[model samples]
Target: MGIFLPNLLVIGGVLILPWVLMLFNYAWWRPKRLERALKKQGIHGPPYKLLSGNIIDEFRALKASHAKPMGLSHHILPRVAPFHLQTVKNYGKTSVTWFGTDPRVNIMDPELIREVLSNKFGHFTKPPPTSLLKQLVTGLVTHEGKKWAKHRRIINPAFHVEKLKRMLPAFSTSCNELVSKWEQWVGSEESRELDVWPDLQALTADVISRAGFGSSYKEGKRIFQLLTEQSELIMQAVQTAFIPGYEFLPTKGNLRRREIVREVKAILKSMIEKREKAMKTGEADNDDLLGLLMESNFKESQEQGNSNSMNIEDVIEECRLFYFAGQETTSSLLTWTMIVLSMHPSWQVQAREEVLQVFGENKPDIDGLSHLKIVTMILYEVLRLYPPAIFLTRCTYKRMQLGGINLPVGVQLALPVLLIHHDPELWGEDADEFKPERFSGGVSKATKNQVSFFPFGWGPRICIGQNFAMIESKLALAMILQRFSFELSPSYVHAPYTVVTLRPEYGAQLILHKL
Candidate 1:
C-alpha cells in the first residue's frame, strides 16, 4: 500500500508540471502573436514587451513628452501611452498597438472608419467586455445585435425632429437661466473674467434635466455631479488598469469609483421607480427626456407584447447615458467654441452679429436657430478641432477584410475621430487652423465633398441624440453670444485631454463682456 501511494504522487506531479509551465507561457512568455503578424505583413511599430506589451514604456515616453510646453497640436498625442497617436503616425494611418494583452489601435483611414461604423453587424460589434462600465451605463451606446436594434427602434422616436422641437422650450429655459446668471456677473461692469467651463457644465446639466428628465435643474444637477465624479474615477482606473492586477487591489481611487457608481445607480433607480409609478397611474409628464423615454418605451412594450421591450432597468440605463453623453458632448463643444471665438474675435463678432440678426433681444426659437448659418459653421469648426468624443472603438468578431488588409478576429480597432477630423490629407493643409468659413456650405462642402466629418459618429450606430444636441448647442451659443462677448482669460491654460471625452484639463476661463 505504501509503494502504491508513492507511485500515485509521482504520477500526479509529473502530469501537473507541463500544464503549469504551459499556463505560464500563455500568460507571460508568449510573444504578442498580433505584433508578429503585423510585422510579417510589412507593418511595424515600437517593439512589444512580454506580457505588459508596450503600455508602461509607451506611457512613460508620452508623459515625458507632454510634460514640456506644447501648442494645441501636441495635445493630440498620447498624453499617457500606449502612445497610440504617435504609433499611428509612425506606422502609417491604419496601424495597431498593444493595450496590455489586447491588440488594438488607431484606424485613421476614413474609409476603414466608415466601414466599421456603417456596416454594423458585419465584422464588428461593440466589444462585450467593458469592465465595470457596463454596470453603470448600458443603453443604446453599448448595445449590439438584436438588443441594439430593439433599443434603437424604441428610442428613435424620442429624438425625432418633432420630439426635439418640443424639447426646445426646455433648452431655451436652460439657456435663459445661464444668460441671466452671466448677466448678474456682468452687472454694470464692462467685463468679468469668468470660468465658462463650470457655467457650460451647469447649463448642459440643466438642459439634460429639463429636456431629458422632465425634472428641475436641482435634481439633474445632483445627478450631473455624481456622474462627473464617477467619470473621473473611471478615467483614472482606465489609465492604470492596463497594468496587471491593478483592478483587484482596493486602492483609494477604485474604492471611491465604486462608491460613485453606487451613488449614481441609486439615484437613477429612485428616479426611474418614481417615474414608472407615475406612468402607471397616468400622472407622468412628458416634458423632459426621462418622461418622454419612459412614455415611449412603455407604449412600445405594450404594443410589441414583449415584456422585455423597455423595462425599468433599461429606461434607467438610457437616462444614465443621456446624462453622461448628452451633457458632456454639449459642454465640451460649447467650451471649445468659446475658446476659439475668443482667440479670433473677428469670428466671434461675426457669429454674434448673425445671432442678433436672427433673434434680436428675444429668446431664439427652434425655427430661428436653424437659420443661423454662421453659428452652425463655427460650431462645426469647433467640433472638427476638438471633437467631444476623441475616438471610437470596435472589436472584430470574425476574420474580415478592412481597407484591403485581412484583419484577424479578436483584433480591436480604435478609430480616432479627432485624428481623422484633423487629418491634413482629408481636411487639407490648413486643417489644424480654426476656420469656420470652411464649413460655410455645410459638412459635405467643408470636407471638399468627402465623408470625413463625424462629430456624432456615423452610420447605423451614430448618436441618436445628435439632432437634439445640435439644436441645443446652437440655441445656447446664440443666447450667450447675444448677451456677452468673451475671450480666454490670461490665466487660462489650454490643456485638452480625453477623459471619456475631449475636455480642457484646466477649466476654460474667459472674460465675459456685456454686449
Candidate 2:
C-alpha cells in the first residue's frame, strides 16, 4: 500500500508541478520582474496586483466615468480613457500599466512611437489577439511574418489607388441612397431632428457591403447582424479575458460566441464558394473588393503556386476585416464630423461653401471630391479630436531597446492616439479646439514632418484602406453639405466613448435644416 501510494504521488507531481510553476511565473514572478525592470528605467505606474492586475481598477474608473454623458467638450480623454489619463498624470507620459500581469508601457512620445511602430528592426510585433478577439476578427491585421507578407501582397492590389477609383461608383451609390433617404424624412418640414448615428452606421455598412461583396446591405444584412451581435458579446467577454480559459468553458456567452462565429463563417464560405465558381465561369465582375482580392489571389497562385496564396478561410477573414474596419473607420469619422461640425457652425459654413464651390450642387465626382480641401481639413481635424481608434498596441516577443529603455520580452506597448492628439506639446494650446485650418496645408505641413497625425496610423503597416475611407468621408460630407445644414439637437448629449471605435454614448441627435 505504501509503495503504491508513493508511486501515485510521484506521477501526480510529474504531471501537475510544471503547470503550477508556469501559473506562478505568469501570476506573480513575471509581473514583479517586469515591474522592477521598468522601475529601474525610471518608468513607473500603478503597482500591479496579482492575476487581475490593473484590469479591475481600469474597469472601475471607466464605469464611473461613463456613468453619465459629459457636457459639450472635446476634452474627452478624461471620459474615454480615464485610467490611461490618470496613469499618465500620476506616472508620466512614458509610463507603465498592467493588463492581467502583462506590463503595458504607455509610450506617448511621437519619436518613440515612431520607432516602435516603424519596427525597422522587427523588434516590436502586434500583441497576439486573445482567443476571444480572434473570434471577433482575424486576417491580414492579425498575421505576422511571411504569412502577413503573403496576405498583404495578395490584398495590396485590391486597395491600390486605381482599384479604389474604380470603386467610386459604389461609394457614390451608397452616399446617394443615404442623403436621398434623409431628404425624404425631412419632407416639407423646414428642419428635422434626426439621430444620424445609427443611420450613418447603416450607410457605412451598406457601403462596405456593396464595395466588398458586390451586394447591397440588405443582401448580406444577416452577416452584419451576426457581426454586430458578436461584437457586443466580444466586448463583454473582454472584461473576463484575463481569467485564463474563461472563454473556453461552455458558458452561455462562450457558447453564443461560438454559434455566432459558426454562422458567420458558414455564410461567408457560401458566398466565397459561389463567387469562386462564378469567376471560373467568367460571369463575375472584377470591380468590387471581393473580386479584386480573388483576382489578386489567383495571380499570386499562378506565379508562386497555391501554397503561397491564402486559402478560402483566409479570404473569408479578410472580407470580415473589410466589413469591420472599413465600416467602423468611415462611420465613426462621419458621425463625429456631423457632431463636431454642428458644434462649430462657422467651420461648417466654410466647409459647405467650399463644397458648394467645388461640386456646385452636382453629385461629387472623384476629381471634385479631391479638390474639396476645406472638407478634407475638417475631416483631418475631426480625426485628430476623435480618432476612430483611440490607441494602438504592440508587444515585444524578444528583449529589445526602445529609445533609452530596454523593453523586456512580452512587454506591451500602448501608443495612446487620443492623448497624443490632445497633447498641448504636440498640437499647441488650442489642441482641444475644433480648428480645421490646422490641416489646411495638408498632413505634412500640419505636423512639420513629425509622426504626430496618424488617425489611420503611420508607417508601412498603416491602414491599407485609409484612402478608401478619406474618399468615402469626403463624398458623404459633400453630399450632406450640399443638401442640409445641421446643428446638435436639444436632446443631444455630448458623450464620446469607445466601443472598439470611439462613438457617441447617447447618440448624435442633430437638427437637419434643409438648405
Candidate 3:
C-alpha cells in the first residue's frame, strides 16, 4: 500500500500537476489579470471566456458576415472587417479583444499604431505564426531585431533603383506578352470581356519568375501555382489556429499543408543548387533577385568580415518571399487600380495622358516611370483606399504603456490599416471617396507629414520590396494604358474581401477597348 501510494503520487505530480498549472495559467489567471489591467485603464472589450476566450464568438461573427457580399460602396470597412467595425462601435477604438487568451488591443489611433510599428526600442515584435503555418513561408517579413537587420542589409542591394532599372526589360517583356495575348482576343474595334484578375496575377507571377529567377515564367510557373495553393491552405488553417493542438491532428488540411510545403521547399532547393553551381563557375553577375541575394550575402561575409550571411535555407525563404509578396502586392495593386480606374474614367484618362505625354508610343523606361506624376498619385490613392495588407500586427514582449494604456507582455496590437486609412478625421470629409488629388502633393503632404499613409507599412522595418513592387506596378499600368482602355463589365460583381490580402470576392471582370 505504501509503495502504490508513493507511485500514484509521483505519477500525479508528473502528469496532473503540469496540466493543472497549464489550466491555471492559460485558462483563468491570464484572462482575469489582463481584463483587470485593461479595465483599470478604462479600456474594456467584450468579456473574455476561459480556454476559448473570444475565439468562438469571433469565428461565428466572421462566418455569418462572410455569408454574402455587401453592397458596392467605397465604405469597405464594414465588408472586409465587420467584426472590427462592430467592435469599435461597441467598445471604442482602444478596446482589447481576445485571440485565444492573448489580448489583442485594437489600436485604431494612428499615433499609437505608428509607435508600435516604429518599435524604436525593439520591445515590440511580430507575433509568430502557428508552427504549421510557419511552414508556409518564413522570410525577413517574419524576422525580428538582429536577424531582421541582417537580412534587410543583405537583401537591400537587390531592390535598389539601379538594379530595378536593369529589370525593366523583364517587366516590359511580361507586359508585352500579356498585351499580345489580349490583342489576339481583341481585334481592332472589338472589346474583350475578360477577367483581368487572373491575367494580372499571371503577369506578375511571370515577372517575378523572369526578374526574380532569371528564367522564363514557364520554368518557374510551378512555384506560383504551389504558392497560391499554400495561401489557400493557410487561410483555412488560420481560422482554426487559435485552437490549441488543432494543427497537430493529421486532418486533410494539416496533411495537405505539410505536403505542399515539402514540395515547395524541394522545388526551391533544386533551383538554388543550379544557381549556386553557376555562380561558382563565374557565369552569373547577381542580376536577378536570387543571384543578387547570394552575391550580396557572399560580399558581406567576405568584405565586412561578417558571418551573418544567409544560409541556403535563408535564401530559399527569401525567394519564397519574393514570389509570394512580390506577386501578391503588384497583382492586387494592378487589379484594383484597373477596377477603380474603370469606375472613374476621368482619372483613368488623366493617368493614361500622363503616361503618354511622358513616353509617347515608346516603352516605359525608368526615367519616364519616375516622371509619371499622375500615375503615381493614382496608385497612392488606391493604396490608401484598399491597401494590399489590411493590417499590421505587433505584440509586446515586455509590459509597456502605449497611448496611455498599460499593456501586459504577450498582448498584441492590431493596427488595422484599412480602418485608419478610411478614417474621416485624418483624411477629411471625403476620406471614403476616391480622391487621387489628396495625394497630389505626395504621401507626406497627404497625411500632413504624419504616419497616416502606410499602405506598405512604416518605420525601420517597412517592406523592403516596396520599390520593386511599385516599379513593377507602374510598368504594368503604363503598358496597359498604352494598349487598351477598359471599363468594368456589367457582369462584374463588387465584393472586396480579405484572403491574406484584400481581394475582390468575385473576379474583376472588365470590357477591354483596344486603344
RMSD (Cα, Å) for all candidates, in order, is 2.7, 1.3, 1.9
lDDT winner between candidates 1 and 2: 2
Instruction: Compose the digit string of candidate 3's lDDT tens values, residues 1-515.
Output: 98999999999899888888887988789888888988998888888887677777876777777776665568887778777778888989788788777888888776776778786437788998658548767889898878888899899999898988888888889999999999888877579899999999999999999999885356579989988888888887866776778988999988988887888788888888888888899877567888888889989888867567888888888888889899998999999999999999999999988989999889888888999989999999999999999988888888988877788888888888998899888998899899999888888789987778898888988888899999999999999999889998989988888887889878999999988
TM-score of each: 0.92, 0.98, 0.96
Give candidate 2's error at residue 39 in angstroms. 0.9
In model 3, the runs with Cα more than 4 Å from the true position are 1-10, 304-306
lDDT of 2 by residue, 91-174 (tens): 999999998989999988778888887853277888998898888889988888888888988999999988988988999998
The better-scoring model by lDDT among 2 and 3 is 2
Root-mean-square deviation of Cα positions for candidate 1 versus the true structure, in angstroms: 2.7
Q: What's the best-to-worst order under lDDT?
A: 2, 3, 1
The Cα error of candidate 3 at residue 30, in Å, is 1.1
Q: Cα lDDT of all candidates, in order?
A: 0.79, 0.90, 0.86
Best by TM-score: 2
Cand. 3 TM to true fold = 0.96
Clashing pairs in 1: 211-289, 212-289, 212-290, 213-289, 214-288
